[model samples]
Target chain A: MALSTHTTTTGFLLPSIHSAPPFFTQQPNPTTQSIASEQWIRLILSYARHRRLFTLRVEDAETAGNDWDEVLRNERINRRVLPSYLSAIIASMAAKNVAAYEPPKQNRSALLYWRLPEEWAEVLHEWAISTGQLNTILTFYDITDPPIESPLTNIPLPLLRKAITILAKTNRAQLIGVADGEGVRFFAGSK
Target chain B: MHRRGVGLAAFDRQEQSKRSFAELSSALSQSQVDHLHSQLSQFRTALAHFASTHRDSIKNDPSFRHAFQQMCSSIGVDPLAGPRKGGWWAEMLGLSDWQYELGVQVVDVCVSTRERNGGLIEMSELLRLVSRLRGVMGGVITEDDVIRSIKTLQPLGAGYQVVDIGGCTMIRSVVKELDEDQTVILAVAQLNGGRIVEDQLIQQKGWTRDRARAALENMLLRDGLCWLDDQDEEFGRSYWVPSAMQWDI
Candidate 1:
């Protein structure tokens, strides 16, 4: 009974049930399976958010090559989540708006939205105002992968775009299409 | 003639004495009846006072509570009856409605989850579920409370009974009675982590191959206590007990 939780490199504490063998297996009963799926959804979102992972591919998750993919399989217990069960869990997550299909039509992969675009927009605006980067043009890469310590560092481009779009809707920020990439110009006092 | 008159006087005297004796006996019996009535009332008052003072203990302690109910029944007092029904014992005990509400919730939890658990649930698991169902409004429901509620459910013949197997208390819905063979299989399965194989039973319990097979099949088909997996190449056919599978989650 040495069941224990694993902490991610980014300091996200995975729940103890993550390592349990049965957690990977699909429950045969509908009610219990639904609960298991809900738990799986919660775990995926939290893990993705903690490690700032924006996308989760079924292949990547099911494979043991990636360190972060340990959640999908418990090797010590020799239990690997079936692909069908994983797809069902992802489908349910998509239904709940917690995740979206990567290509919109294909269910092969999903972009986890632990924090919705609206929430990310608020976080971005707050960061800009506090850091005095308002009223200046910042490239998408600069905003997502800033050299200095910032919460928005390493944000996925698609999620970043969504967040910027939310700010654009509120007239707090404007998007600039450059020859190479896109840039966002935040307006001071336009909150 | 003088002798005849004397005899008549004596007969009259005897008749008068007999009448006086009858009156004396009646008066004596009436006083005894009054004394007995006073004693009964006094005893009832004392019992009521005792119940009120020890209400908490009686509610929390299983054995004590059982004894208290027995005592009440012996005196023709129903402690489980509604308080507003003017039963002195019920009012003093103040556990009737509480027990009744818990009983209703227990039945709900048990009935709703019966399909998954096959009408058999570990006592601790049942308590956890009942507590979750009741939420904040239900306060605390102890093991004793569950037992007491199950007791109240006995009259309904809902097949609610507590079974002790391998030192763990399991509540089995008597709707489907488990015969001796099924009971033995369940006990064996509990020891093997909610799973049992025909070979294990035959080897350990010294049962013949036919007897083990019959018992296992009966449990799977009739009692719904097991799930069969013909996919097990090693075991041939493996029976798994869902209730005994303790998922930490």
Candidate 2:
């Protein structure tokens, strides 16, 4: 087989290596496995960043119709990354610090760090300043489920909290308590 | 006038002996030297004429170049001995420069793909990659040309070698040697399009499970020559040798 590159239905260009049958398997050789894992990590991060996805679970490989379907499985070759193999890949990614176990306790799933929390901090601050939401008390729910969709919209709570914490260090933000749950007030902190 | 020489003096044992043997020997040597000088000049003129007329053919035409190389060997000439070893005759053709340039490109392709193929590349794959690297203007090259270029690379002692395994030609850029069982594994993998399973080896080669596993594991773990496919459909695990695989890239 040529193992040519293919464009997915979602318009992401898959690298040619993704079409190879053995690419889905967890390699036994450390060197070979490292190369494969490096490729998978790069592919995963880029795809997650493209679709604005932030989570990857072993269950996604077990079931169908998940956001990672395009990558975790190659329907053409009848090959899919087995759950155990994907778990191994996730563990590898976590070891590399490119990803982490989501919920902070489970190993089967990961919180994809498409954008690190530090990067998200800058984006968060820039978003608040540009939208004229500065000096306003914005609740966690309001930022994640904004009326107008935003970079932060649908962002997982823990990741959003981490970004807020990073901003609080720079004195660009302050945490407060609203009537419902919790909130944060933005400050035009000196640059 | 020569009749007196045919007298008894001509048969003298020690008096004359055909006007002294030393003088006759010197006379023969002088004439032989003159004849050899004329022959050497003629050969040089013919060679110079051939070099000027067919230099481009030697450089650009593969078939013509092959024929020319054959003729050189038939005449006991080493074209690739180059100007350093041989005289300026081969240099006049500039064919060694072409050969050396092609060798560089061959090394380029081999080194670039060494990581994926584990320094063992199929001959045809190496040819295709080298051709693509040269681009359209680089002219077309045949497998013969690549083999010849590799010969030019032998002096570098980087251990570039052409190996024949089960009738397939492979270029091995790495210095490593393949053990007997690994050789069989590679040949089988080539037939199956780079995929090999332990069961197949056990059945076809009459190898025991332990022998098969040892060979496959050595290839996968020790050499990094083959990749492990744990999710194989028919078998849970299979070995895929990248060098044996036909990659269009």
Candidate 3:
């Protein structure tokens, strides 16, 4: 049978290589493994962007129904990436800086950087300016769980803090202590 | 014939006539030599003119190029030989440029897809990618054209070689040789739609399980010629030779 691209029920199009069974296995050759790693990295980051998923856990490969299911498993071929292989791919992603282990010290899970923190910083600033929230004190809750949905909605806390930290370097945002959690005040900083 | 030579003067006269005859023959052959030279130059001029006029068709038309190449071979000329090497057909046709450009593309596709296929690509897939790289302006290229372009790449010593396995043509970009077992595995994988298991090899080729495993493992670890698929429903593990596999993309 010809290996072809398949669209998942959730509307993500898996590349044709995804249909190939070897793609799920960890290749023995470093060169071949690198190819698999790159494909997985690209698929993961793109899927994360498509579904607004910010985190990938190795345990997701152990079971279905996670945000990574559409990519980590290929039911048509009766194949799913082993947790070992998924962990390797994640580690490669981490080494390449496309992802980072969230909470700083553990390696089981990572925050997927579909958009790197630098890019997220711009998005956060732009949203603050457009929504007339500039120069206002907004809690992390206000940004992550906005009244209306946002690009930042459901963004993991660690990634959000990274973006905020990046912005603070430019004086575009300042961290301020709040009653329940920390808040941030945005400024109409110069480019 | 009229009278017998009577003295030394008669003998000297006979010698003079013989020398004159030799001189006449030499003069006649010199003219023939000059005529032959002009004829050869005329042939060269005509071939050069023909090459210049139909250069585009020679580069853009596959059949025409094939026919032209056949004609060149029949006439004992190499279509690719350059002027520095003393053959003018390539120079006048400007076909070598077209050919070298194609060689570059052949390498491009082979090198770019090396990771996926382990430096061995199916011939048809190589042609597809090369034609795509050339875009519409590159015109149609045939299998002969690809083979010819590959020939031009020989001097680079990059170990690009065309190998026939399982009745399928594959280009191997790496220098490694396909051992006897690996060759058989590739042939069987081609028959299996790129999937092969130890049982399949044992049943079909009568190989022991250990032999099958060793060959597949070498392909996977030593050459990167095949990929390991651990989730095969029947065998639980299978080997896939990407060069034998048909990739639609």
Candidate 4:
């Protein structure tokens, strides 16, 4: 087969010889798989951060099919192959501790913040400064709720919980349990 | 006498040894001794088995390698970086829980956003906001976000009436401000404009055809709103036109 070449804006040169058929396939050869998977991981993290995408509905994709061509071009997000191909990438990332998996629920979508733990920690710090809620109780939901940018909203719930747990350990935030007449909710606020 | 002394010494030594043996025997029952020995052996076997099994499973089972993939699929979540702790963690996330038992419901036509974008709030924001807050904070503009975006130009004058028809809530006003009557009639009139139909209005605002028509007629009498000439006694069969318009002020 005739070989081709492409260069990303980052100046990385990729040989396009084998990119014709297998590149589009969900399961590629080992080398191609690794490259594609890494690229996909990097792409999702960077793209999602740029958009600050916290929630994605299936219908949103349908709408975006016309509008957000750049995002829609990424084969990684094809919901048609979602439960299989896309899920595997998430699993791999979780296994490597490179990201978190927040299991999706109805009305709730998975958020993957490419921002690091330290970034999230810094955001929490800034939130403390702005809200003056130091040494106070805040719910897990409160941290992710608006009024400021939070990794919790942009990341999946499972990962967000992990981030909170990490913050608690670092003495960055305090998680308190308060009960009104109903049940208890976990409140995490900066210390 | 010397020979007898030697035999007695030997017997005394033998008795001492026998007492020591008896004490050891009494300390442990037969079953207990057996159980201890067996448990030690079992522990060794279990450790060996666990180590070898984990090693083998890692190599053999692709499912074990990609278990997190399955969890994400079942959970309807996009995956990210974190620890993979299998089924228990999955359950903790409530991935398989009833949060979605009713299934993912997409509002076919999002009304809340439309209300804000269409500037319908200038026409009706205050009245609705006040009515909602009636049981609470005295109709203050306490609602901060999108509700404010849809706020009406003026508060509904005190001369408004709230009517409940067949368990559906409708508001009526004479002096000014679009009340429940105008809103329902507007909804009915707007139905032909691809805004809403009878069932949708009924479902969304809890207005039956009877209630919607009464509200429509009241608006017509006031020369404020209009509806299609096609009339019906039943609320569902009739259509309406709401005169949500601007006057030459």
Best by DockQ: 3
Q: What would the per-residue lDDT of candidate 1 be over residues B1-249, giving only the tens digit for each residue? A: 245345678889778878999999999999999999999899878887888888887866767888988987998877767553345644766456667777888888777656545778778767877888767434377788899889877756788988887677888874667777777777777776676899988988899999999888777666566655443446645776656655333
lDDT-based ranking: 3, 2, 1, 4
Candidate 4, A18-120: lDDT as tens digits? 2222222343234335545665566556556666654333343344453223432333222222334455665565555455544533322334557666667
Give the distance in Å from residue A39's predicted Cα in candidate 3 to where it truly belongs. Answer: 1.1
Cα error, residue B226 of model 3, in Å, equals 1.0
DockQ of each: 0.02, 0.40, 0.49, 0.01
| Model 2 clashes, total count | 0
Q: Give the best candidate by TM-score.
A: 3
Tell me which of candidates 1 and 2 scores higher on DockQ: 2
lDDT of each: 0.75, 0.85, 0.86, 0.42
RMSD from true fold, candidate 4: 29.2
- Candidate 1 clashes between residue pairs 3 or more apart in a chain or in different chains: B159-B174
Off by over 4 Å in 1: A1-16, A188-191, B1-91, B94-120, B124-145, B149-168, B172-188, B195-242, B246-249
TM (chain A), candidate 4: 0.58
lDDT tens digits by residue: candidate 3, A1-191: 78778888899888889988888999888988888899889999999888888889999999898777888888888889889888888899999999999867988898899999999999999999999999889999999999999888878788888889999999999989999989999999899
Q: After superposition, how far is residue B109 of candidate 2 from its true place, in Å?
A: 4.0
Candidate order (DockQ): 3, 2, 1, 4
